[model samples]
Target: MNFNFLDKLSPEYRNYKIERIKNGASKKLFFKISKGSDSFVCTDFNSDKLEYKNHLVVHRILSNIDISIPTLIEKNDDKLIIVSEDFGNLRYDKILKQQSIKDLLQYATDTLCIINKEINFNPTYTLPQYNIELFKNEIAELPQYYFSYNNIIDRIDSLNDEFFDIWIESFKQLNFNFKHFVHKDFNMNNLIFLPSREGHLKCGVIDYQNSFWGESSWDLFSLLEDSRIFFTDQYNAYFMNYFYSHSNQLISLKEFKLKYHLLNCSRQTRLLGRWVKLANELNQPWYLDFISTTKLRLQSSLAILQNNKLTKFYDKYIL
Candidate 1:
């Protein structure tokens, strides 16, 4: 598809030899420029005020912590261009598919440890407003979009009221002491793997606009329980132990287990609503593919909640 914004570039930017790389959501287009000595990336925004500002905030905040995010080169009212060290064509998703579990887990653990240490939590960021209430409201509204899929929609609809009530109650019951800047979408696709000087792998994070101050467990779950890639249970156990052993502030295994399940459910609930909305209202059918995976994760989390003494109340009310 021809991106309409490319033709509207300022005369100075139009001189560059532009190569369209790929198309992304929200009418964003990524391009590679050949005019400059160093290659740069140009992202065309679709006049979405919130989204544009969110991207700018991510760039500024992550860069301030010395994270290797792409540096902002320039921004017009509708476009934000950035330049930085490129990782060639190596993506973390590709690495996981081709590499061994041990190697991938090690890389992920080291990278997350670095990020956990460097991130500065900002109380003013609006992203963290995505709490349990927001999640419940989103799920409660999803049935409107999925109503056409009678059987699935009906099943989802049947649980909506109960789900939201229990979810909100559970959020209030749980301790929210855990606080850190979480990359809300911290999955392999948003990570770039580059070779380090010591001949090992290093990671660079990307697409951090949804970042917020929330439970660190959510980020850990996103890494270990990624929908695109599955980690072996044995490997997950080993990695979780590795993190607990190495961290200066130790997190108990039991606590980690509980938080992991809760965060997993929270994430899947949000994802389910998003997919339903995208497919039904936005006319994007591809998101439907995620339904099965989201259901699986939700069921697993519900099972864990049922087993926990603290969350067993969910069994009487929610399940």
Candidate 2:
């Protein structure tokens, strides 16, 4: 529980105060370590939990690309803790309520532009490909958890078959480009607002160990169509246009829109099921509060995609 490694950095750290950060929906333990007015984050994980290694590798990758991320202070693998600079409590999720959407999304879109252009197909650290198999696996959570929770487990096998058939068919038709970098959870909660930083750097990203090579629109939808927050259709349209016009990607807006909606549906479906898993298995009922919001988002995405088969499936069973 103590950051013994910090003692070597400075004698004052020996008396630091530590408190748990109970925010993320992960197995990792994050603690805020304070020494007088200064503070750092201590990430504690078991040896089997090697996400810290991914964090370290991604920290290097993002840092090299000039993305704003917390500075790594120390790594004590023996003690299973990684210490890094603390960005305080200014997470973008909390800020969304107070700031204008235009102002807030500008910084977020700017950061996304950088990520789209800068990140390579194969970085120094190897990443798992976001292929069809992985996509199906993720959406399977809907039937496995959500259906089971709602007592719709009777025809789960046939339901899953229909569900995946619609998705796989739509996915193949999309022919999505999967070469770009996807900060898999690139949403408001993972961003820290740094007022002092300039331009896109003002958007500080964290908890990106789950980063992978995937469609750029996946992260776009992650930011715009966040499961935790609801943005009106008009606002979503304006920003999607803003990101497309500014980034200057070669894809047409129509194609981009389809990709965005498709991915958002996939994401929201996973989260819909995940809420049940979190409530029943993780003992986190608060996640269930977002179920309505997540369901609405999924429905919206499904509507946008205009897949009758998928829409009918949701109407009949999952929705």
Candidate 3:
């Protein structure tokens, strides 16, 4: 947790002392630099070069759309930093822990509405437009962390081949038409809650370096189905209804439900793989705690797909 990088800053930047913020899943070291009128956030990026670049692109794009995020401060050869409007230490998740359930859902609904308005639907950056072959190719390249975890390999082998085949084929049949810029990690942990003019909640988005042209529901799923915070069913229903009502061209309820389930499954599977890789390869065992949660999600998705409703579809192609 020692962020010695702040000490390496040039004399001009040295005035910005480092403040350790131990709130995120990733290692975050916030640098509080003294600018005449504003304080900037200097977060470290140990991710690959492409990931760093993507983070900048997302920050710029979202900022241009008037989405409330920290302003990009500067990017040196080694560090990426941004000067943002300081919204103190009130993360949405922390607020939920102390606030009413109704307030949490209201904020969630409003946040999604803002995102839907800000993002333009563009297919090129969307995940659904990624063809099945490409999807398989990308997933196939994913390391053994996904398939070989504790008893996960056994589970995969035990699962009926017919079910697995259908799972792959069903992925191809899914409709991917709706596309928009998604804050890939739009969970509560990354959102800051500030008091609005009316004394209600105003949200500021963060950690969007992973933003991409993807499903409109990606962010929603990330927020509602967050592993760290549990949302009530009533709140979830209210939020979903609010989103569908506001979206001018929303998907059918059936399609929406399908996509929601499928995407959740896909995300959890990827997360499981990532956790295992982090533990075995990166030597980060902190990720192991998420494996069971991810496994349950995967199992739930599989059960949903196995329903009698989709049996014919499964038999014809998957079996």
Task: Provide backbone clash counts, one per model.
Answer: 0, 0, 3
Q: What TM-score, computed on C-alpha atoms, does each candidate reach? A: 0.78, 0.92, 0.76
**lDDT digits (tens) for residues 39-111 of candidate 1:** 6666655645666778877777767654446566667654554333445556777766676757756776766
- Which 10 consecutive positions of candidate 3 have the poorest summed lDDT? 310-319
Please list the residue runs of candidate 1 whose C-alpha ends up more than 4 Å from where it truly belongs after superposition: 1-15, 24-27, 35-38, 77-85, 124-130, 141-158, 196-201, 229-233, 245-251, 307-319
Q: What is the lDDT of candidate 2?
A: 0.81
Q: How much RMSD separates candidate 3 from the native structure?
A: 5.0
Which candidate should be chosen as best, given lDDT against the real structure? 2
RMSD of 2: 2.2
Q: Return the TM-score for candidate 1, rounded to 2 decimals.
A: 0.78
| lDDT for position 167 in model 1 | 65
Per-residue lDDT tens digits for candidate 2, residues 1-319, read 4455445334546778867788557787787889678999877766345687777777777887867889988876666667888988888889867777677777888888888778777854677778999999999999888887777977778887888889899889887877788889998888888888898888888889888888888777888788887765457888788778876477899999988998899899899999888888878798888888898888888888888988998888877
Model 2: how far is 91 from its true place, Å? 1.3
99-169, model 3: which lDDT tens digit per residue? 67576556655666666776676544423333455455444412345544534344454443544465587
Tell me the deviation in Å of residue 218 in model 2. 1.4
